[model samples]
Target: MATGFYTHPDCLLHDTGDGHPERAARLQAIEDQLIGSRIDIALQRETAPLASETALLRAHSAAHVAAMRACVPATGQAEIDADTFVGPHSWNAALRAAGAALAATDAVIDGHLDNAFCCVRPPGHHALREQAMGFCLFNNVAVAALHALEARHLARVAVIDFDVHHGNGTEAILAGDPRVLMCGFFQHPFYPFSGVPPLAPNMLNVPLAARSDGAAMREAVTREWLPRLRAFAPQMIFISAGFDAHRDDDLGNLGLVEADFAWLTRCIREVAAHSAQGRIVSCLEGGYALSALGRSVVAHVRELADL
Candidate 1:
Protein backbone atom coordinates (compact mmCIF):
# COMPACT_ATOMS: atom_id res chain seq x y z
CA MET A 1 0.00 0.00 0.00
CA ALA A 2 1.06 3.59 -0.64
CA THR A 3 1.94 5.80 2.30
CA GLY A 4 -0.72 8.32 3.28
CA PHE A 5 -0.26 12.09 3.12
CA TYR A 6 -2.76 13.80 5.41
CA THR A 7 -3.43 17.54 5.17
CA HIS A 8 -6.15 20.21 4.89
CA PRO A 9 -6.51 23.58 3.16
CA ASP A 10 -7.75 25.05 6.41
CA CYS A 11 -4.25 24.49 7.78
CA LEU A 12 -3.06 27.42 5.68
CA LEU A 13 -5.78 29.67 7.05
CA HIS A 14 -4.60 29.34 10.65
CA ASP A 15 -2.45 32.42 10.24
CA THR A 16 -0.22 33.56 13.06
CA GLY A 17 0.87 37.05 11.90
CA ASP A 18 3.36 38.91 9.77
CA GLY A 19 7.00 38.02 10.54
CA HIS A 20 5.81 34.83 12.19
CA PRO A 21 7.94 31.83 11.28
CA GLU A 22 4.95 29.46 11.38
CA ARG A 23 3.06 31.20 8.62
CA ALA A 24 0.87 30.05 5.72
CA ALA A 25 3.75 30.02 3.24
CA ARG A 26 5.38 27.14 5.09
CA LEU A 27 2.76 24.70 3.77
CA GLN A 28 2.84 26.32 0.35
CA ALA A 29 6.59 25.82 0.21
CA ILE A 30 6.15 22.10 0.84
CA GLU A 31 3.42 21.69 -1.76
CA ASP A 32 5.44 23.65 -4.27
CA GLN A 33 8.43 21.40 -3.74
CA LEU A 34 6.32 18.27 -4.18
CA ILE A 35 4.93 19.54 -7.48
CA GLY A 36 8.28 20.87 -8.62
CA SER A 37 10.00 17.54 -8.04
CA ARG A 38 7.11 15.43 -9.41
CA ILE A 39 8.08 12.81 -6.84
CA ASP A 40 6.45 9.56 -7.88
CA ILE A 41 4.62 7.60 -5.22
CA ALA A 42 1.07 6.27 -5.09
CA LEU A 43 0.28 8.83 -2.43
CA GLN A 44 -2.95 8.17 -0.57
CA ARG A 45 -3.90 11.82 -0.20
CA GLU A 46 -6.49 12.45 2.50
CA THR A 47 -8.20 15.61 3.74
CA ALA A 48 -8.33 16.25 7.46
CA PRO A 49 -11.55 15.84 9.38
CA LEU A 50 -12.74 18.06 12.18
CA ALA A 51 -11.92 16.26 15.40
CA SER A 52 -14.92 15.80 17.69
CA GLU A 53 -15.15 17.33 21.11
CA THR A 54 -15.28 13.84 22.55
CA ALA A 55 -11.99 13.09 20.82
CA LEU A 56 -10.50 16.33 22.10
CA LEU A 57 -11.71 15.47 25.59
CA ARG A 58 -9.79 12.22 25.40
CA ALA A 59 -6.58 14.30 25.50
CA HIS A 60 -7.75 17.62 26.98
CA SER A 61 -10.12 18.99 29.62
CA ALA A 62 -13.61 20.34 29.00
CA ALA A 63 -12.69 23.85 30.13
CA HIS A 64 -9.53 23.87 28.12
CA VAL A 65 -11.33 22.67 25.05
CA ALA A 66 -14.10 25.21 25.43
CA ALA A 67 -11.65 28.02 25.97
CA MET A 68 -9.73 27.39 22.77
CA ARG A 69 -12.91 27.12 20.76
CA ALA A 70 -14.14 30.37 22.26
CA CYS A 71 -10.92 32.14 21.34
CA VAL A 72 -11.54 31.89 17.61
CA PRO A 73 -12.00 35.36 16.16
CA ALA A 74 -15.06 36.29 14.16
CA THR A 75 -13.12 38.30 11.53
CA GLY A 76 -9.63 38.97 12.83
CA GLN A 77 -7.19 37.34 15.26
CA ALA A 78 -7.08 36.56 18.95
CA GLU A 79 -3.94 36.07 20.96
CA ILE A 80 -3.92 32.90 23.02
CA ASP A 81 -0.53 33.30 24.65
CA ALA A 82 2.81 35.07 24.28
CA ASP A 83 3.65 33.25 21.05
CA THR A 84 0.29 31.76 20.04
CA PHE A 85 -2.52 33.40 18.09
CA VAL A 86 -5.72 32.42 16.29
CA GLY A 87 -7.30 33.97 13.24
CA PRO A 88 -10.85 33.65 11.93
CA HIS A 89 -10.05 30.22 10.49
CA SER A 90 -7.97 29.13 13.47
CA TRP A 91 -10.59 26.88 15.06
CA ASN A 92 -11.13 24.72 12.01
CA ALA A 93 -7.45 24.66 11.14
CA ALA A 94 -6.47 23.59 14.64
CA LEU A 95 -9.20 20.97 14.50
CA ARG A 96 -7.86 19.69 11.19
CA ALA A 97 -4.31 19.53 12.50
CA ALA A 98 -5.39 17.37 15.42
CA GLY A 99 -7.83 15.46 13.25
CA ALA A 100 -5.23 14.69 10.60
CA ALA A 101 -3.17 12.87 13.22
CA LEU A 102 -6.19 10.85 14.32
CA ALA A 103 -7.06 9.92 10.75
CA ALA A 104 -3.46 8.93 10.05
CA THR A 105 -3.51 6.74 13.14
CA ASP A 106 -6.70 5.03 11.99
CA ALA A 107 -5.38 4.50 8.46
CA VAL A 108 -2.11 3.00 9.71
CA ILE A 109 -3.98 0.69 12.10
CA ASP A 110 -6.40 -0.44 9.37
CA GLY A 111 -3.49 -1.51 7.09
CA HIS A 112 -4.26 1.10 4.43
CA LEU A 113 -0.62 2.14 4.45
CA ASP A 114 2.69 1.30 6.08
CA ASN A 115 2.87 4.87 7.42
CA ALA A 116 1.42 8.40 7.13
CA PHE A 117 2.75 11.96 7.35
CA CYS A 118 0.50 14.74 8.65
CA CYS A 119 1.18 18.12 7.07
CA VAL A 120 -0.48 20.35 9.64
CA ARG A 121 -0.14 23.77 11.20
CA PRO A 122 -0.68 25.85 14.34
CA PRO A 123 1.65 23.21 15.65
CA GLY A 124 0.67 21.22 18.74
CA HIS A 125 3.72 20.10 20.70
CA HIS A 126 3.74 23.25 22.83
CA ALA A 127 0.10 23.27 23.81
CA LEU A 128 -0.50 21.82 27.23
CA ARG A 129 -3.63 20.04 28.53
CA GLU A 130 -5.04 23.34 29.83
CA GLN A 131 -2.72 26.02 28.44
CA ALA A 132 -2.04 26.95 24.83
CA MET A 133 1.47 28.35 24.61
CA GLY A 134 4.52 28.61 22.39
CA PHE A 135 2.77 28.84 19.03
CA CYS A 136 0.59 25.82 19.75
CA LEU A 137 -3.09 25.30 20.45
CA PHE A 138 -3.82 21.56 20.70
CA ASN A 139 -1.52 18.62 21.28
CA ASN A 140 -1.99 16.89 17.89
CA VAL A 141 0.38 13.92 18.33
CA ALA A 142 -0.72 13.36 21.91
CA VAL A 143 -4.35 13.48 20.85
CA ALA A 144 -3.64 10.89 18.17
CA ALA A 145 -1.72 8.69 20.58
CA LEU A 146 -4.63 8.80 23.02
CA HIS A 147 -7.06 8.11 20.19
CA ALA A 148 -5.00 5.12 19.05
CA LEU A 149 -5.21 3.52 22.50
CA GLU A 150 -8.52 4.78 23.90
CA ALA A 151 -10.61 4.82 20.72
CA ARG A 152 -8.84 2.40 18.37
CA HIS A 153 -7.98 -0.12 21.15
CA LEU A 154 -4.27 -0.35 20.41
CA ALA A 155 -2.46 -1.74 23.46
CA ARG A 156 0.84 0.15 23.30
CA VAL A 157 2.29 2.97 21.14
CA ALA A 158 5.62 4.76 21.07
CA VAL A 159 5.83 8.50 20.24
CA ILE A 160 9.27 9.62 19.07
CA ASP A 161 9.31 13.43 19.17
CA PHE A 162 12.39 14.87 17.41
CA ASP A 163 11.44 18.51 17.47
CA VAL A 164 13.99 21.24 18.12
CA HIS A 165 12.06 22.33 21.18
CA HIS A 166 10.86 19.91 23.84
CA GLY A 167 7.34 18.59 23.46
CA ASN A 168 6.20 19.82 26.83
CA GLY A 169 2.55 19.41 25.96
CA THR A 170 2.96 15.83 24.71
CA GLU A 171 5.09 14.96 27.74
CA ALA A 172 2.49 16.46 30.07
CA ILE A 173 -0.33 14.41 28.57
CA LEU A 174 1.37 11.04 27.96
CA ALA A 175 3.89 11.00 30.80
CA GLY A 176 2.43 8.54 33.29
CA ASP A 177 0.65 6.25 30.84
CA PRO A 178 2.45 2.92 30.71
CA ARG A 179 0.71 2.18 27.44
CA VAL A 180 2.89 4.77 25.68
CA LEU A 181 6.65 5.12 25.59
CA MET A 182 7.60 8.74 24.76
CA CYS A 183 11.20 9.30 23.66
CA GLY A 184 12.77 12.42 22.16
CA PHE A 185 15.79 14.77 22.08
CA PHE A 186 15.42 18.55 22.19
CA GLN A 187 17.59 21.63 22.78
CA HIS A 188 18.02 22.26 26.49
CA PRO A 189 17.22 25.48 28.41
CA PHE A 190 14.97 26.59 25.61
CA TYR A 191 11.33 27.58 25.30
CA PRO A 192 8.85 25.93 27.70
CA PHE A 193 11.80 24.34 29.47
CA SER A 194 10.37 21.38 31.40
CA GLY A 195 11.79 18.24 29.82
CA VAL A 196 15.07 18.50 31.71
CA PRO A 197 13.34 17.57 34.95
CA PRO A 198 10.88 15.12 33.47
CA LEU A 199 7.70 14.37 35.41
CA ALA A 200 7.09 10.70 34.66
CA PRO A 201 8.80 7.39 34.05
CA ASN A 202 7.57 6.61 30.54
CA MET A 203 8.96 9.95 29.30
CA LEU A 204 12.52 9.42 28.00
CA ASN A 205 13.63 12.99 27.27
CA VAL A 206 17.23 13.30 26.01
CA PRO A 207 18.05 17.00 26.29
CA LEU A 208 21.07 17.70 24.11
CA ALA A 209 23.37 20.61 24.76
CA ALA A 210 23.31 23.69 22.54
CA ARG A 211 25.08 23.39 19.12
CA SER A 212 24.88 19.58 19.18
CA ASP A 213 24.94 18.24 15.62
CA GLY A 214 23.25 15.36 13.84
CA ALA A 215 25.92 12.87 14.96
CA ALA A 216 25.03 13.63 18.58
CA MET A 217 21.39 13.17 17.72
CA ARG A 218 22.13 9.72 16.24
CA GLU A 219 23.98 8.72 19.37
CA ALA A 220 21.08 9.77 21.59
CA VAL A 221 18.68 7.82 19.40
CA THR A 222 20.92 4.73 19.56
CA ARG A 223 21.91 4.80 23.24
CA GLU A 224 18.87 6.39 24.89
CA TRP A 225 15.75 6.06 22.71
CA LEU A 226 16.44 2.63 21.18
CA PRO A 227 16.57 0.65 24.45
CA ARG A 228 13.26 2.00 25.76
CA LEU A 229 11.53 1.37 22.45
CA ARG A 230 13.05 -2.12 22.06
CA ALA A 231 12.05 -3.12 25.57
CA PHE A 232 8.56 -1.71 25.09
CA ALA A 233 8.07 -3.18 21.60
CA PRO A 234 5.31 -0.75 20.70
CA GLN A 235 2.38 -1.96 18.67
CA MET A 236 2.59 1.23 16.61
CA ILE A 237 5.13 4.04 16.19
CA PHE A 238 4.27 7.76 16.10
CA ILE A 239 6.79 10.48 15.26
CA SER A 240 6.58 14.16 16.15
CA ALA A 241 8.87 15.00 13.20
CA GLY A 242 9.99 18.61 13.43
CA PHE A 243 12.61 19.85 10.95
CA ASP A 244 13.42 23.09 12.77
CA ALA A 245 16.50 21.29 14.07
CA HIS A 246 17.99 21.75 10.62
CA ARG A 247 21.18 23.78 10.50
CA ASP A 248 19.59 26.61 8.58
CA ASP A 249 16.52 26.92 10.80
CA ASP A 250 16.71 29.69 13.40
CA LEU A 251 14.53 27.86 15.88
CA GLY A 252 17.39 26.07 17.69
CA ASN A 253 21.13 25.48 17.65
CA LEU A 254 21.10 21.85 16.56
CA GLY A 255 22.81 21.57 13.16
CA LEU A 256 20.95 18.83 11.29
CA VAL A 257 20.19 18.95 7.58
CA GLU A 258 18.05 17.07 5.05
CA ALA A 259 20.35 14.05 5.07
CA ASP A 260 20.15 13.99 8.87
CA PHE A 261 16.36 14.06 8.68
CA ALA A 262 16.36 11.17 6.20
CA TRP A 263 18.73 9.24 8.47
CA LEU A 264 16.56 9.85 11.52
CA THR A 265 13.46 8.74 9.67
CA ARG A 266 15.32 5.60 8.62
CA CYS A 267 16.21 4.76 12.22
CA ILE A 268 12.68 5.35 13.44
CA ARG A 269 11.32 3.32 10.54
CA GLU A 270 13.53 0.39 11.48
CA VAL A 271 11.90 0.33 14.91
CA ALA A 272 8.48 0.23 13.24
CA ALA A 273 9.61 -2.34 10.67
CA HIS A 274 10.83 -4.66 13.42
CA SER A 275 7.86 -4.32 15.74
CA ALA A 276 4.73 -2.72 14.26
CA GLN A 277 4.25 -4.01 10.71
CA GLY A 278 5.83 -0.74 9.70
CA ARG A 279 2.83 1.20 10.97
CA ILE A 280 3.97 4.77 11.61
CA VAL A 281 2.19 8.11 11.85
CA SER A 282 4.30 11.26 11.78
CA CYS A 283 2.91 14.76 12.34
CA LEU A 284 4.67 17.98 11.43
CA GLU A 285 5.83 19.89 14.51
CA GLY A 286 8.38 22.63 13.71
CA GLY A 287 10.52 23.85 10.79
CA TYR A 288 10.52 27.57 10.10
CA ALA A 289 13.17 28.61 7.57
CA LEU A 290 11.25 28.43 4.31
CA SER A 291 14.01 26.97 2.14
CA ALA A 292 15.48 24.74 4.79
CA LEU A 293 12.09 23.52 6.03
CA GLY A 294 11.07 22.75 2.49
CA ARG A 295 14.11 20.60 1.74
CA SER A 296 14.22 18.92 5.16
CA VAL A 297 10.55 17.87 5.15
CA VAL A 298 10.72 16.64 1.55
CA ALA A 299 13.62 14.45 2.58
CA HIS A 300 11.61 13.13 5.53
CA VAL A 301 8.35 12.40 3.63
CA ARG A 302 10.37 10.96 0.74
CA GLU A 303 11.84 8.41 3.14
CA LEU A 304 8.56 7.91 4.98
CA ALA A 305 6.78 7.27 1.68
CA ASP A 306 9.88 5.35 0.47
CA LEU A 307 9.74 7.16 -2.86
Candidate 2:
Protein backbone atom coordinates (compact mmCIF):
# COMPACT_ATOMS: atom_id res chain seq x y z
CA MET A 1 0.00 0.00 0.00
CA ALA A 2 1.05 3.60 -0.49
CA THR A 3 2.26 5.68 2.40
CA GLY A 4 -0.46 7.53 4.31
CA PHE A 5 -0.48 11.35 4.15
CA TYR A 6 -2.25 13.44 6.83
CA THR A 7 -2.86 17.19 6.83
CA HIS A 8 -5.55 19.78 7.52
CA PRO A 9 -6.68 23.09 6.03
CA ASP A 10 -6.54 24.67 9.47
CA CYS A 11 -2.81 24.14 9.39
CA LEU A 12 -2.55 26.62 6.56
CA LEU A 13 -4.79 29.02 8.44
CA HIS A 14 -2.40 29.30 11.40
CA ASP A 15 -1.00 32.66 10.48
CA THR A 16 2.32 33.47 12.14
CA GLY A 17 2.31 36.95 10.61
CA ASP A 18 4.23 38.93 7.97
CA GLY A 19 7.88 37.98 7.31
CA HIS A 20 7.68 34.95 9.55
CA PRO A 21 9.75 32.00 8.40
CA GLU A 22 7.15 29.45 9.51
CA ARG A 23 4.27 30.57 7.33
CA ALA A 24 1.44 28.90 5.47
CA ALA A 25 3.44 29.16 2.27
CA ARG A 26 5.69 26.38 3.47
CA LEU A 27 2.94 23.78 3.13
CA GLN A 28 1.80 25.32 -0.09
CA ALA A 29 5.31 25.00 -1.47
CA ILE A 30 5.39 21.32 -0.56
CA GLU A 31 1.99 20.57 -2.06
CA ASP A 32 2.80 22.56 -5.17
CA GLN A 33 5.98 20.57 -5.61
CA LEU A 34 4.20 17.26 -5.13
CA ILE A 35 1.53 18.23 -7.62
CA GLY A 36 4.12 19.56 -10.05
CA SER A 37 5.99 16.25 -9.78
CA ARG A 38 2.75 14.25 -9.72
CA ILE A 39 3.71 12.50 -6.48
CA ASP A 40 0.48 13.40 -4.70
CA ILE A 41 -1.46 10.92 -6.84
CA ALA A 42 0.66 8.04 -5.61
CA LEU A 43 -0.09 8.47 -1.92
CA GLN A 44 -3.11 7.98 0.36
CA ARG A 45 -4.45 11.30 1.58
CA GLU A 46 -6.57 12.02 4.65
CA THR A 47 -7.77 15.08 6.55
CA ALA A 48 -6.33 15.37 10.05
CA PRO A 49 -8.67 15.09 13.01
CA LEU A 50 -8.70 17.54 15.91
CA ALA A 51 -6.73 16.26 18.88
CA SER A 52 -8.91 15.87 21.94
CA GLU A 53 -7.90 17.35 25.29
CA THR A 54 -7.46 13.80 26.57
CA ALA A 55 -4.97 13.00 23.84
CA LEU A 56 -3.26 16.35 24.32
CA LEU A 57 -2.92 15.58 28.01
CA ARG A 58 -1.03 12.42 27.10
CA ALA A 59 2.06 14.60 26.50
CA HIS A 60 1.12 18.04 27.82
CA SER A 61 -0.09 19.51 31.06
CA ALA A 62 -3.65 20.75 31.40
CA ALA A 63 -2.23 24.01 32.61
CA HIS A 64 -0.22 24.33 29.44
CA VAL A 65 -3.24 23.57 27.30
CA ALA A 66 -5.36 26.09 29.14
CA ALA A 67 -2.59 28.68 28.95
CA MET A 68 -2.20 28.26 25.22
CA ARG A 69 -5.93 28.45 24.75
CA ALA A 70 -5.97 31.65 26.74
CA CYS A 71 -3.31 33.08 24.47
CA VAL A 72 -5.49 32.67 21.40
CA PRO A 73 -6.33 36.15 20.05
CA ALA A 74 -9.80 37.09 18.97
CA THR A 75 -8.71 39.59 16.35
CA GLY A 76 -4.95 39.40 15.61
CA GLN A 77 -1.85 37.44 16.53
CA ALA A 78 -0.51 37.33 20.07
CA GLU A 79 3.12 36.62 20.82
CA ILE A 80 3.53 33.77 23.25
CA ASP A 81 7.31 34.01 23.22
CA ALA A 82 9.96 35.97 21.45
CA ASP A 83 9.49 33.76 18.39
CA THR A 84 6.20 31.92 18.89
CA PHE A 85 2.85 33.49 18.10
CA VAL A 86 -0.79 32.43 18.18
CA GLY A 87 -3.46 33.82 15.88
CA PRO A 88 -7.17 33.08 15.96
CA HIS A 89 -6.59 29.80 14.17
CA SER A 90 -3.32 28.84 15.88
CA TRP A 91 -4.94 26.74 18.59
CA ASN A 92 -6.93 24.59 16.20
CA ALA A 93 -3.97 24.37 13.87
CA ALA A 94 -1.80 23.13 16.67
CA LEU A 95 -4.47 20.62 17.56
CA ARG A 96 -4.62 19.40 14.00
CA ALA A 97 -0.83 19.20 13.79
CA ALA A 98 -0.76 16.91 16.81
CA GLY A 99 -3.98 15.18 15.82
CA ALA A 100 -2.45 14.30 12.49
CA ALA A 101 0.33 12.54 14.34
CA LEU A 102 -2.07 10.49 16.44
CA ALA A 103 -4.22 9.65 13.42
CA ALA A 104 -1.12 8.59 11.52
CA THR A 105 -0.08 6.35 14.38
CA ASP A 106 -3.50 4.65 14.45
CA ALA A 107 -3.46 4.11 10.70
CA VAL A 108 -0.04 2.48 10.82
CA ILE A 109 -0.86 0.37 13.85
CA ASP A 110 -4.25 -0.79 12.54
CA GLY A 111 -2.66 -2.07 9.30
CA HIS A 112 -4.29 0.54 7.13
CA LEU A 113 -0.82 1.67 6.08
CA ASP A 114 2.73 0.57 6.65
CA ASN A 115 3.91 4.12 7.28
CA ALA A 116 2.53 7.65 7.38
CA PHE A 117 3.62 11.29 7.07
CA CYS A 118 1.97 14.29 8.75
CA CYS A 119 2.56 17.48 6.78
CA VAL A 120 1.09 19.90 9.28
CA ARG A 121 2.46 23.27 10.43
CA PRO A 122 3.75 24.93 13.63
CA PRO A 123 6.44 22.36 14.36
CA GLY A 124 6.23 20.70 17.77
CA HIS A 125 9.68 19.56 18.91
CA HIS A 126 10.54 22.79 20.71
CA ALA A 127 7.36 23.19 22.72
CA LEU A 128 7.76 21.91 26.24
CA ARG A 129 5.05 20.28 28.35
CA GLU A 130 4.13 23.57 30.04
CA GLN A 131 5.20 26.22 27.57
CA ALA A 132 5.00 27.03 23.89
CA MET A 133 8.30 28.23 22.46
CA GLY A 134 10.48 28.16 19.39
CA PHE A 135 7.64 28.27 16.90
CA CYS A 136 6.01 25.17 18.38
CA LEU A 137 2.71 25.06 20.23
CA PHE A 138 2.29 21.33 20.83
CA ASN A 139 4.60 18.34 21.02
CA ASN A 140 3.14 16.24 18.20
CA VAL A 141 5.69 13.40 18.03
CA ALA A 142 5.73 13.04 21.81
CA VAL A 143 1.96 12.69 21.83
CA ALA A 144 2.20 10.03 19.14
CA ALA A 145 4.88 8.11 21.01
CA LEU A 146 2.76 8.09 24.14
CA HIS A 147 -0.28 7.08 22.08
CA ALA A 148 1.58 4.11 20.63
CA LEU A 149 2.55 3.05 24.12
CA GLU A 150 -0.61 3.70 26.13
CA ALA A 151 -3.40 3.55 23.54
CA ARG A 152 -1.98 1.01 21.12
CA HIS A 153 -0.49 -1.13 23.92
CA LEU A 154 2.97 -1.09 22.43
CA ALA A 155 5.73 -1.72 24.91
CA ARG A 156 8.49 0.14 23.16
CA VAL A 157 8.80 2.91 20.60
CA ALA A 158 11.55 5.10 19.12
CA VAL A 159 11.65 8.81 18.25
CA ILE A 160 14.23 10.14 15.79
CA ASP A 161 14.62 13.92 15.49
CA PHE A 162 16.95 15.32 12.81
CA ASP A 163 16.02 18.93 13.11
CA VAL A 164 18.70 21.64 13.02
CA HIS A 165 17.84 22.37 16.65
CA HIS A 166 17.46 19.99 19.55
CA GLY A 167 14.05 18.51 20.41
CA ASN A 168 14.04 19.90 23.93
CA GLY A 169 10.29 19.33 24.32
CA THR A 170 10.40 15.72 23.18
CA GLU A 171 13.29 15.05 25.52
CA ALA A 172 11.46 16.77 28.34
CA ILE A 173 8.33 14.68 27.80
CA LEU A 174 9.75 11.17 27.15
CA ALA A 175 13.26 11.31 28.53
CA GLY A 176 13.11 8.82 31.42
CA ASP A 177 10.46 6.51 29.99
CA PRO A 178 12.16 3.15 29.44
CA ARG A 179 9.48 2.20 26.93
CA VAL A 180 10.63 5.07 24.68
CA LEU A 181 14.08 5.49 23.16
CA MET A 182 14.74 8.92 21.62
CA CYS A 183 17.66 9.47 19.25
CA GLY A 184 18.47 12.72 17.50
CA PHE A 185 21.15 14.80 15.78
CA PHE A 186 21.26 18.58 15.90
CA GLN A 187 23.71 21.41 15.37
CA HIS A 188 25.62 22.28 18.48
CA PRO A 189 25.27 25.71 20.10
CA PHE A 190 22.12 26.16 18.08
CA TYR A 191 18.68 27.28 19.13
CA PRO A 192 17.27 25.91 22.42
CA PHE A 193 20.70 24.62 23.38
CA SER A 194 19.92 21.89 25.90
CA GLY A 195 21.04 18.60 24.33
CA VAL A 196 24.73 19.19 24.94
CA PRO A 197 24.62 17.05 28.11
CA PRO A 198 21.58 14.90 27.23
CA LEU A 199 19.58 14.70 30.45
CA ALA A 200 18.03 11.25 30.02
CA PRO A 201 19.53 7.77 29.81
CA ASN A 202 17.15 6.79 27.00
CA MET A 203 18.40 9.65 24.84
CA LEU A 204 21.22 9.27 22.32
CA ASN A 205 21.82 12.96 21.58
CA VAL A 206 24.58 13.50 19.03
CA PRO A 207 25.60 17.11 18.61
CA LEU A 208 27.27 18.08 15.34
CA ALA A 209 29.22 21.28 14.87
CA ALA A 210 27.91 24.14 12.77
CA ARG A 211 28.53 23.76 9.00
CA SER A 212 28.71 19.95 9.35
CA ASP A 213 27.39 18.12 6.33
CA GLY A 214 25.72 14.81 5.53
CA ALA A 215 28.94 12.83 5.82
CA ALA A 216 29.10 13.80 9.47
CA MET A 217 25.44 12.88 9.86
CA ARG A 218 26.06 9.48 8.25
CA GLU A 219 28.89 8.84 10.67
CA ALA A 220 26.74 9.81 13.64
CA VAL A 221 23.92 7.57 12.48
CA THR A 222 26.10 4.55 11.76
CA ARG A 223 28.14 4.89 14.95
CA GLU A 224 25.60 6.28 17.41
CA TRP A 225 21.90 6.23 16.49
CA LEU A 226 21.64 2.92 14.59
CA PRO A 227 23.34 0.74 17.21
CA ARG A 228 21.28 2.15 20.07
CA LEU A 229 18.06 1.99 18.06
CA ARG A 230 18.70 -1.62 17.04
CA ALA A 231 19.41 -2.64 20.61
CA PHE A 232 16.23 -0.91 21.79
CA ALA A 233 14.17 -2.86 19.23
CA PRO A 234 11.27 -0.42 19.10
CA GLN A 235 7.82 -1.74 18.19
CA MET A 236 7.09 1.46 16.28
CA ILE A 237 9.13 4.43 15.05
CA PHE A 238 8.30 8.17 15.20
CA ILE A 239 10.27 10.72 13.25
CA SER A 240 10.42 14.45 14.00
CA ALA A 241 11.23 15.28 10.40
CA GLY A 242 12.90 18.74 10.16
CA PHE A 243 14.30 19.96 6.87
CA ASP A 244 15.90 23.24 7.99
CA ALA A 245 19.17 21.38 8.15
CA HIS A 246 19.30 21.61 4.39
CA ARG A 247 22.16 23.82 3.21
CA ASP A 248 19.83 26.08 1.33
CA ASP A 249 17.92 26.98 4.49
CA ASP A 250 19.20 30.00 6.36
CA LEU A 251 17.81 28.79 9.67
CA GLY A 252 20.99 26.91 10.55
CA ASN A 253 24.35 25.86 9.14
CA LEU A 254 24.12 22.05 9.21
CA GLY A 255 24.66 21.89 5.44
CA LEU A 256 22.34 18.97 4.71
CA VAL A 257 20.65 18.57 1.34
CA GLU A 258 17.79 16.56 -0.10
CA ALA A 259 20.06 13.53 -0.52
CA ASP A 260 21.03 13.66 3.14
CA PHE A 261 17.37 13.71 4.24
CA ALA A 262 16.66 10.78 1.88
CA TRP A 263 19.66 8.80 3.16
CA LEU A 264 18.72 9.27 6.81
CA THR A 265 15.12 8.33 6.05
CA ARG A 266 16.29 5.13 4.39
CA CYS A 267 18.41 4.36 7.44
CA ILE A 268 15.40 4.86 9.69
CA ARG A 269 13.31 2.59 7.45
CA GLU A 270 15.95 -0.11 7.62
CA VAL A 271 15.94 -0.04 11.39
CA ALA A 272 12.13 -0.03 11.46
CA ALA A 273 12.03 -2.97 9.12
CA HIS A 274 14.41 -4.83 11.38
CA SER A 275 12.49 -4.25 14.60
CA ALA A 276 9.30 -2.17 14.31
CA GLN A 277 7.33 -4.28 11.78
CA GLY A 278 8.05 -1.50 9.32
CA ARG A 279 5.75 0.94 11.11
CA ILE A 280 6.77 4.61 11.04
CA VAL A 281 4.88 7.82 11.71
CA SER A 282 6.77 10.96 10.75
CA CYS A 283 5.74 14.56 11.56
CA LEU A 284 7.08 17.83 10.29
CA GLU A 285 9.18 19.85 12.73
CA GLY A 286 11.09 22.67 11.01
CA GLY A 287 12.32 23.77 7.58
CA TYR A 288 12.15 27.42 6.53
CA ALA A 289 13.49 27.95 3.04
CA LEU A 290 10.48 27.26 0.87
CA SER A 291 12.21 25.58 -2.05
CA ALA A 292 14.58 23.55 0.09
CA LEU A 293 11.82 22.47 2.46
CA GLY A 294 9.63 21.34 -0.39
CA ARG A 295 12.41 19.43 -2.15
CA SER A 296 13.70 17.84 1.05
CA VAL A 297 10.22 16.69 2.08
CA VAL A 298 9.67 15.13 -1.33
CA ALA A 299 12.93 13.26 -1.01
CA HIS A 300 12.15 12.05 2.49
CA VAL A 301 8.57 11.07 1.64
CA ARG A 302 9.63 9.36 -1.55
CA GLU A 303 11.98 7.17 0.44
CA LEU A 304 9.36 6.60 3.14
CA ALA A 305 6.81 5.52 0.52
CA ASP A 306 9.47 3.47 -1.34
CA LEU A 307 8.18 4.86 -4.63
lDDT of each: 0.88, 0.93
Q: Candidate 1 lDDT, tens digit per residue, 1-307? A: 8788889999999978788788999888887777676762457899999988888888899999999989998876788776888899999999999999998899889988789989999788888899899888899999999999999998999999998899999999998999999998899988777898888999999998889998998888888888789889999998998888888888788898899899989888888888888999999999988888888878988888887
Residue 174 Cα positional deviation in candidate 1, in Å, after optimal superposition: 0.7
lDDT for residue 252 in candidate 1, whole number 0-100: 87
Error of 1 at 232 (Å): 0.7
TM per candidate: 0.98, 0.99
Pairs in steric clash, model 2: none
TM-score of 1: 0.98
Model number with the top TM-score:
2
- RMSD, each candidate, Å? 1.1, 0.7
Global CA lDDT computed for model 2? 0.93
Model 2 spans with C-alpha error above 4 angstroms: none
Q: How close is candidate 2 to the true structure, as a TM-score?
A: 0.99
lDDT of 2 by residue, 191-307 (tens): 898897988899999999999999999998999998899999999999999999999999899999999999999999999999999999999989999999999999999999998
* Candidate 1: clashing residue pairs, number: 0
